[model samples]
Target chain A: MTFKKFWVMAYRDLLRNRRRTVITFVAIALGLTLVIFMNGLITGMLDGMLRDTIRLDTGHIQIRAESYEVVKTSLLWRDLIDNADELAARAAAMPEVAAVSPILWASGVLGTASESTSVRVSGIDPASALFDPIREGLRAGEFLSGNGRGQILIGQRLADELGVGVGDRINLAVGNPDGVPQEGQFTIVGLINTGFPGIDNANVFLSLAQAQSITGSGNRASTVRIMLHDINDTDKVVAALQTPGLTVMGWRQLNEFIMTTMETGTAVYSILYAIIFLVVAVIIANTLLMAVFERTREIGILAALGMKGRQIMTMFLFEATILGLIGSLFGIILGAIVVYYFSINGIYFGDLGDVAGSLAFGTSLYTTLVPANLFLMAFWMLVVIVTVSLYPAWYAARLEPIEALHAL
Target chain B: MAAIELEHATKIYTIGEVETRALDGVSLTIEEGEFTALVGPSGSGKTTMLQLMGCLDKPNSGTVKINGQDVTRLNANQRADLRREKIGFIFQFFALVPVLSAYENVELPLLLNGVGAKERKERATALLEAVGLADRMDHRPDQMSGGEQQRVAIARALAPRPLLVLADEPTANLDTANGEQAMDIMARLNKETGTAFIFATHDQRVVAYAQRIVKMRDGRLVDGNANGSAK
Candidate 1:
């Protein structure tokens, strides 16, 4: 039979059983929705993490001391980026490279006249490019004095825990210029909240020179930090710059659990895809099988009228494809609505503190949109519907005209 | 030339432990342009003989031929082609596809044979008009009366312009008036186009329209008369 006639017969068959066709679509829609929702949830989690991580700590990507990879301890002669000043200039000159800052980061102890706390002090350039979330977190006073500072910019959580406000003097204990433990005093200049629970409670920022002085490293930074025009290509920059003794880490590698979870969620989404498609295939197959049985006599009459076996097969397959198309469309629409609603009005648990703490950075999560999921679900079911109709089409084509005509 | 030929044809059916022979040692030949009737009560093998002659079934023991081709050995595909090219069927109960209109039902045979749309429409329109159903061309089978539906069936049977038409109980479901009208149409078509027809029926009125009549009983042809006009 011609393509036109095949389609005509298929459409007629589907219209004859409109209720069954509608139900088949609903099944596809539900399966596709699950796929879209799961996809959104997985993507949303990682995107949220990367946003916060860049805001408070690593600005897209960061350069740390070569030794920082293996031993994250106080620096005592790591493979230094030789001539850090020249390399900083080279990085800053590249069009894709943005501002460059040399920071002296060290883990140390802070004490006041009354109390003390463990602190991670970052020696910063204090004036880098447009709206760094880490910099935005600073709430009071300036980061560094114009003539350099004998001052500290404290995080709000640390200030709250320590009962210190701006203008309070604090003594920072560090290794002195002779590599011996030494003490220095500075006035609190600013207080900030970065929103990263870990950093907000612990970070302190100082001028690069002051930080260098406290760490007893003369005119040398712990590491030179290069900010890029596009953070997405941090790995490419690392590949282009990884020397023999130094290692590079992307923001993703910094937190193993987040990357691993992203992978796990993706893998889980694929399994859900399999289950959803399998359901569509089975439903379509079962429906077509019954449909063929019901139309046996009709098929016989058509055949006796000289309709070819292949035409019969084509008709049934066309019906199956139409079923898939309608189902997938409805599914994508419904699924998108559900995904959108959930993404906008996220589920929250105020008591999720301990639970979130136990999770990777432990917080209750929300879903975001991932377009590929809906498309993927629709494509998956299209294949399923087409494939599932095969045996039934062939079965209808194989019916003996005489026997089927005499069938009651 | 004979339009249908059956030589020692037999059909065996497996019914549990019992084997029922639907056709036993049947042999007959129908000449072109002859309106032949195979008349018998139910289960007397008239329908079986009609099916074999129409190329719808293959015999186990012997040969069956239509329009000089030995169709018993043809595969299902070849058999369908044979039916398309040279044969048409008028069924007992007006087995019109419920979904299609009267015109589409008649258009079906031509469509399957790869006829183009304009020609198919023209042919179907002409045939339905010949069958006195031009005004009801768009009416579906379920929407039409039994006689109107049977007229549509006649138009379908003639659409392909086959030399032979095999009808199994063509008037069995119709009342006498509709049945007689349907027979008159077939007789007129047979006279006009010289299209041979082989009908299997218990209806004596159905037998009246045939030019030759064959009597069947107990899976065998017992007697026959040429120029069928007998009771």
Candidate 2:
């Protein structure tokens, strides 16, 4: 039979069972909507965290000491990018390279005449830093701008422990860039609380000139933080720049565990998504099968009336495909509805005390729309529905007309 | 030329573990432009004989020829092609697809033969008109009377221009008056168009329209050593 004719027959058959087809469509739509909406939430939360982390802590890429590259936790810092000023200028001139800031960073003790706390302080050129003016975190006195004399910025949590505020005399003690224990006193300039316990409690800010003065170093910083338009192109830019004693570390290397966790979570999400989709597939399959069985005599008549077995199969397949199409279309709409609802009024995870602590990122959770996920769910569900449709088609085609007619 | 010719035709059905003979070594030939009837009591293989000629069932052993094509030796695809190209069937229940309109019912066989939409429409409209259903072309089977549905079935049987039409008690569902009207229509079509008809029926009233009647008993030809004809 011609395609037009076959499709008409198939369409007619489908129209006869309007209610059942609608139910099947709704089933697939609901399943796909769940995955799309949930995936959107995770994507949103992850994007928020990435922006916070990237905007403040990791500047897309960090050019560090080779020693820090090998044993990242090692305190053996490097002040040894031989041509730091020249290389930073060269990289900054590139279009893709957004910013290059030299950061004198180390972990040490923050103290005063009153109290003390552990702190992670970075001494950076305030004007050159891309974002998160470490100065913002110093919720206290001024940033001791351009003063060759020492200055300090402390975290809010660290400030509470130290019993101090801006203009208070605080002694900053750190092992010098050369491993020599160094001590200096600076007026507290700021106190910061960024909602991240890691940053809010332990971070401090200072000027590179002041850090160098306190540590007795000249024209040297611990790391050159490189920000780029494309984070994944670290290798291309890193290879382009030849610097002595400098090691290039992209965000992937800097946050290896987090990225890996993202990958594993994605894989798990796919499996779960597939399971839910299969449930909908079963729903569709069961609906089509029951339909085939119920229309056995009708199918038999069609088959006996010079309708090819293949055409019969195509007829049912067309029916299933139509059901899937309607389902997927509704799924996109339903997914949009749920996405809009959750986007405006976020889902709450109330009082997640210990649970918050366990999360690798932070406590805030929100769904987001990921196109890959939507496409994946949509394509996979369609395939499942169509694949499930085949068995019913084959079974329907196999039904003997005489027996099927006799069935009634 | 003959319409349907069968040589040594036999049919066996498996009922559980037992094989029962529905038609045992029966051979019959129906001629073109003739109104022939196979009359027998229930379970006497009258319907089986009609189904065989209609290509709705395959015989256990036989050379069944329709317009001289050896249909018994053909495959499933070929059988469907043969049925589409040459054979037409009318069921006892009128067998109008309930979802379709009167016009679509007649258009089915043409559709099977892959007739173009315009031509199919024109031809089906003409056929429905011939069956006196022109005004009721859009009416569904349930909306039409029993006589109207049967007439639509008659129009469908002629849609493909098949040389032969096999009807299994085509009037069984109609009342006496409708049945008479249906028989007149079938007889008129047979005479005017010269399309052969093979009817299997137990109704004695149906036998009156037939020019030749063959009687069967116990699945065997009961000719009694003569060419039996109740003309």
Candidate 3:
């Protein structure tokens, strides 16, 4: 039969039972829509978390000593980056490098009149772009103006625990030049809230020079955090900055847990899509089977008219293709609308509170509509729908002309 | 050459252990352009003979031939190809594809034969006009009366200009007037196109219109001009 004739016949057969066809199409459309929306939401959440983490904590790449250990017990200056000014200038000179900030990290305790808490003291250049989050998050007072004037910036959670606010005096104790414990009195100049539970509860910022002075490490830092023009250039920049005694790490390598979770979430989402499409397949298969039974006499008539078995099968498959195309078209439109709305407004999860924690860093969830994923899902749905219709098509093809004509 | 020849054809229907012979050692030959009717009571095997002749069913222990070619050895697809090119069928209930218009139903066989668009259009239009459905060409089966639907089926059967048409109870559902009208169209088309037609039916009205009658009783041909004289 001519291709046009086959399609015409297939379309008319679907119209024989309009209600069932419409219902099956709706099932496929709604299933695809759910898949698209879920993928968009999860993708947006991961993107947001990665961007926030890169911007706030890990930069795009960090260069540290080869033997650097995160859990350092002693205040040894041997593992610190030497000639930090020269290395920072070298990193900043690369075309792909955006900004690099040298930081001296020390384990210290902050004591006030009421409470004392052990904190991770991050000494930063308050003027550099690396401190942009702290600058943006200033709740009260002013940020540190110069290198070492006895000024400090504390997170809101830490301030709350210490019962101190801006302008309150907090005593910081660390190792001095003699490798002996020494105390330095500093006034809290700023109280900042980054909203990330992990950062807000543990980090206290000071100037790099002041931290070096307090830890007796003159002109040295633990690491030089390098930001790139684009996060995608992380590996290239890391390869370029591979020095003799320095270990360069990308943000993904530093945050292994987040990357693992993102991969797991993606795999789980794919399985979810498979299950949803499987349900769609069952619905389409059942509808076509019922159609085959209802059209037994018609199939017999076609057979008697000298239609081949493969032609009969092709007719039914064509019906499924039409239904799948229409349904997936509508599904993409619907999913785009929903995802666009959520992308603009975001879903508020005030009840989630700290559930955002370090991963999401916020209570409101947004969605991103990835067009390629939507297109792929629609294509897969079409393939699956056509495949699922094969069983019923085969049944129709195998119908005996004489027996089917005699079917009551 | 005969349009169709069935030699010692036998068909048995087995229902779990009870076997009944539907056609028993029946031999028949239908010439081209002959308007023949196979007339009998129920279970007389007239329909089975028609099915065998139409290449729709295979005989158990006999050879069936179409236009001097033995078709008993033809596979299902080859048989279907032969049918498409050499035979047509009109069912009892007018079995029109209900979704298709009268024109499309007539054009279906031509389409199946891979006829080109221009020739297919010309042939289908001419046949629909011949069947006197030129004005009702755009109407579907549900929109047409019983006689009109049967007339469309007649045009469809003749679209490919096959050598033979097997119509099983072609007018069983129509009233007397409609039945006579349908039979008149078939007879006229047979005479005009020289396409042989065989009718399997118990309707006397249909039998009276045939140029020759073959009668069967209890799965065997008993008497008729095609065999011998009336028993």
Please estimate how well model 2 matches the true structure, expressed as its whole-model Cα lDDT.
Answer: 0.76
Number of backbone-clashing residue pairs for each candidate, in the order shown: 3, 13, 0
Q: Which pairs of residues have clashing backbones in candidate 1?
A: A29-A331, A356-A362, B211-B228
Q: How many clashes in candidate 2?
A: 13
lDDT per residue for candidate 1 within A150-260, as digits (tens), equals: 888888778878888899888888764345776788899988765566666777777877887777676666666666778777888767666555555666666566668
Off by over 4 Å in 2: A61-79, A82-100, A107-121, A125-193, A197-207, A210-217, A226-257, A351-364, A370-376, B224-231
Writing each residue's lDDT as its tens digit, candidate 2 over B150-228 gives: 9999999889888888898898999999999889888988887889887899888889888988888878767642133
Q: What range of 10 consecutive residues in model 1 chain A has the weakest lDDT sum?
A: A353-362
User: How would you encode candidate 1's per-residue C-alpha lDDT over B116-160 as one tens digit per residue?
Assistant: 889999999998988889899989888999999999998899888
**Higher-TM-score candidate of 1 and 3:** 3
**Candidate 3 residue lDDT tens string, A21-138:** 8898799889999989998999998988878877888888888888887445245666788977788888999999888989888878889876888888888998898778768877
Q: Enumerate the candidates' DockQ scores in order.
A: 0.56, 0.42, 0.62
- Candidate lDDT (C-alpha), each: 0.78, 0.76, 0.86
TM-score of B chain for each model? Answer: 0.94, 0.94, 0.96
Best by TM-score: 3
Residue B145 error, candidate 3, Å:
2.0
Candidate 2 lDDT, A52-133, residue by residue in tens:
5666777777776666642232234353444556667888987879889876666678887767776776777767756344
Worst 10 residues of 3 chain B by lDDT: B222-231
Per-candidate Cα RMSD to the true structure, in Å, reads 5.1, 4.3, 3.6
Interface RMSD of 1: 1.6
